[model samples]
Target: MPVVLSLNIAQRTVPVDYAQEGATGIDKRPVDGPLDVRAPGPKGTAGSGVAGDAIADIVHHGGEHQAVYAYAREDLDWWQAELGTDLRNGQFGENLTTSGIDQTHARIGERWRVGTALLEVTAPRIPCRTFAGFLGRTGWVKRFTQVARPGAYFRVREPGTIASSDEITVVHRPEHDVTVELFFRAVLTEPALLPRLLEAGDSVPPEIIDLVHRRTTVQLDS
Candidate 1:
């Protein structure tokens, strides 16, 4: 059993100062330290256009892994084991933090119970220009995209109030070839990753799948 270092839940508004309309510019700014958990999204609330769990868009807050998140608490703690990190807020640049279990072996279509909310792991966050800002370097986005460690997103199966440090349990797991890690890796390196994600997107977060489809389209057009 892994321990959840910390738990954080916030509201996501929209029209954030840096997060824009399109997929290309969603991630911006580096969030630092922790803010009140009562606010929407991480740190503070955003605009109206982008609100919810699937979109924990971060901008200039933390330093290590800005805008990182986990839909299921099990995966959140599990990933801490795999990453060998304490799941610290400022350390990992994680805007939204969780504790419970690991997510290294989790996949899409998987179901998890966290507190009163039941959710399914949807898709991985694909790094972009905004990610580079966290590193304060150029091309780091490409490097991170290459490693494919983007965390998981869960769709609310049963909606309820979710508090910090709640217990998470797995209800179902998918029989897919790709792990969450592989999905992130494949999405960035292999064009084939798109087709698989597209099919599974039905169960994934629409925003994330939309990103996969958008990137695939960009690749095709290019």
Candidate 2:
């Protein structure tokens, strides 16, 4: 059984030279106990899972499609060596740091029950300038992209409280070939894999689904 290694939350803080106003919740630290998990309302609405958790950059951070972010502890271990730095649970900006789970290969639309809430894997986090800025590493975006273990974002299906050490069990997995890694590669590294994303059906987020549809339509028309 996969387990939640840590429950992390952060208050907004503007670290010097962070390049963004307000605190980037990326510097999340582990909390002592159970934390509420719920949808952050609509896309434009701002909300946080933990009571004091902050989402400073609202535009790209919150919403139903990305309510909670999960990163594998193993992946963090991998980065520890690569970056020669100590990384804790929320270091990657993930809400839930998990162990014994292969987040990269998790099929899109897969459902995992953590504590009482049910979460469905919605999309792979695409690295952005904000993430690179957080790390403050040279060529970090490219380097992170190349590693291709970008953590998975999950939408809350059944809202409830989750605590550290709670068992994470897979409840459902859609029949699809579009794993998180495949989706990442399809969009960022290999455009040719775009069509394969269609296999995941409704599991893929609307934004990605639309993008893939538009691209495939163009290819067909040509």
Best by lDDT: 2
The digit string of per-residue lDDT tens for model 2 on 1-222 reads 799999888767556455465456677888877988887776557656455677777667777778888999999999999889999889988888999999999998899999999998988988877688888887888998899999998888899889999999999988767899999999999999998988877767777889988999899999
Off-target runs (Cα >4 Å) in candidate 1 are: 2-4, 9-68, 71-87, 90-96, 198-201, 205-222
Q: Model 1 reaches what TM-score against the true structure? A: 0.58
Query: Which stretch of 10 consecutive residues in model 2 shows the poorest summed lDDT?
Result: 13-22
- Candidate 2: stretches off by over 4 Å: 13-23, 47-51
lDDT of 1 by residue, 98-210 (tens): 44455656777777765565666655666555445433556767655654556665555564444444566788877765567766765667756666765554665444467
Residue-pair clashes per prediction, in order, are: 26, 1
Q: Rate residue 30 of model 2 by lDDT.
A: 88
Task: Judge candidate 2 against the unseen true structure and give its global Cα lDDT, from 0 to 1.
Answer: 0.84
TM-scores of the models, in the order given: 0.58, 0.92
